[model samples]
Target: MKTVALVYSQHTAQTAELGGRIAAAWGSEVVYLDPDTTRLEDWMKYERFILGTPTYFDGELPDSWDEFLPELEDADLSGKKVAVYGLGDQQHYPVSFADGVGLLASYMEELGATIVGETSTEGYSYEHSVAERDGRFLGLVLDPTNQPELTDQRLAAWLEQLKVAFAG
Candidate 1:
């Protein structure tokens, strides 16, 4: 089985929801880390990462993730595979508000994580399974209105990719 570290800065319910999906579908153990915990081993042991969070203001980066990124400046994840996802208010903010995934992608780059690009707009997967599939064709449209349920197929495929990358 694979092990994935789902890191996020959000309410416990949200974090748990996402982590639960990953654990169940991917046959991977899941770890939920909030904004305050240390990420020292996260980079080494976990071959892949799923970063999640909510949008604050107009696509502005959350302080916790911001701080966390700099903290990882010394960590080496250059060859690891990483993907990002986020939940946010679509009506109240700019489209960029949902861009935490991108910021996290960039942050991983700083740490040497070879990003595979952002994952599907999990928000959509929670609700529209069809939209999630459409994402496979459209490449990541980032639907803020969509609520996605981390499906088995989706999680399994993602895990398989990371497993191959890590197998070296």
Candidate 2:
């Protein structure tokens, strides 16, 4: 299995918690990297990455992720694999639920990274979201605020898919 780095914003409690859970579920090969303090060179060390973020007010990317955009843009991720997970409140912001995942995935794809682990949108109640493409979420979309019960199951399934995707 390829070494995977789970990158997230440590400042956002929900995102941080989700990142921890993902890392634990992924086992020892996964390393946690906080985007705030992770150097640009550090990002190049891993070819497989799981990025987590909580959608801020009205679908905005959190501050730490927003600030790290330049570094990501500068990095060369050609042939790399990235899976994104985003936290959002589907009940409160249905129109923009988990848009951060889409935004980040798009940027990474632009940088030549192959985005993986897209999930079905069947269980979600969101009206609209940039995260949806071709009727599926760009990656895992967890609504812990309204549907915490489903998070674990969703994470498990997504992680399984990622293992296969990253292995290639």
Candidate 3:
């Protein structure tokens, strides 16, 4: 089985829960990126790396992941599949919840990680959330309010696509 590392900086534990779902779905490993971790190396070492995080107030990105900016410059992810996901509440940060993943996506590209397809979601940042199930990048714009099932199912679908994309 291929390995996909789920890296995230979370507050409400929703991001961590998403990682659990993804791990269960793919039988992969969940690694935290907060306070520096040996798992960051897993990002380059694994066949696929999934960057997961929770959005902050007014679109503020997690401070810890910013460290990735410089480190990624020296890494090589060429043809190595990668994806990003973010979980956030619907009340705050009305927009830009999924922007963090895009930031990671940009860096992954610089490092040569092949971005599978589809990106961003706003809702379903919790356990059993579809984002983990699908394994794709998400933003969570409207979340449970606009479309309750939108985030989770979309996430699950993304995961499914990643499997196929890497397999092919």
Candidate 4:
């Protein structure tokens, strides 16, 4: 089975860029889709998934991701490996910072996938987040709006962690 990196965003390319970087780092196929684009199928062919999206409208995922989520929910992803990465303006939406990541992680969890890449909440300055569970972000969280300089470092670290997790 193969690994897939998928992403959807409406406004900026940051989310797509991050997803591409992840796919490159992992040497996997990266797929970018809009809400109205062709739907992804054959879930059972991919043993692992790395997903990315941007938070929208007060802690919600982009419309494309929201719409695509139902398909994922319907898939039998049990025993698969999954991880999420998301972009959010922590300073602006502290209450819902990276909530999209949390939403994706929760869905994967519910589908019985082994979620990987849980990140520490130490560097981020958020009041509350759906992404936080057990004092960690549900997955990777990037804030290009607030801390663009750290994106590379954070991505590198998270990718390293994912490599280890994927190997185990």
- Measured on C-alpha atoms, candidate 3 has an lDDT of 0.58
**After superposition, which runs of candidate 1 have C-alpha atoms over 4 Å from their true positions?**
10-15, 117-168
lDDT by residue for model 4 (1-168), tens: 244545555454888777667766766344444543535464455666777778887988777776777777667677788888888898999899889899889988888898999999888898989999999998899999999999999999998888777665
Best by lDDT: 2
> By TM-score, who's the top model here?
2
Scored against the true structure, residue 44 in model 3 reaches a CA lDDT of 59
- List the global CA lDDT of all models: 0.55, 0.90, 0.58, 0.78
Give a tens-digit lDDT track for model 3, residues 56-156. Answer: 55555676676556666777777777767665554444444445555666667777777765654333343322232255443322244445567577768
Regions of candidate 4 where Cα sits further than 4 Å from its true position: 9-12, 28-40
Q: Estimate each model's TM-score.
A: 0.64, 0.96, 0.70, 0.87
Kindly indicate the candidate among 3 and 4 with the higher lDDT: 4
Query: Which lDDT tens digits does candidate 2 get at residues 1-168?
Result: 878999998888888888888888889899888888888798899999999988888879988888888887767899899999998899999899999999999999999999999999998898889899999999999998899999989999998999999988
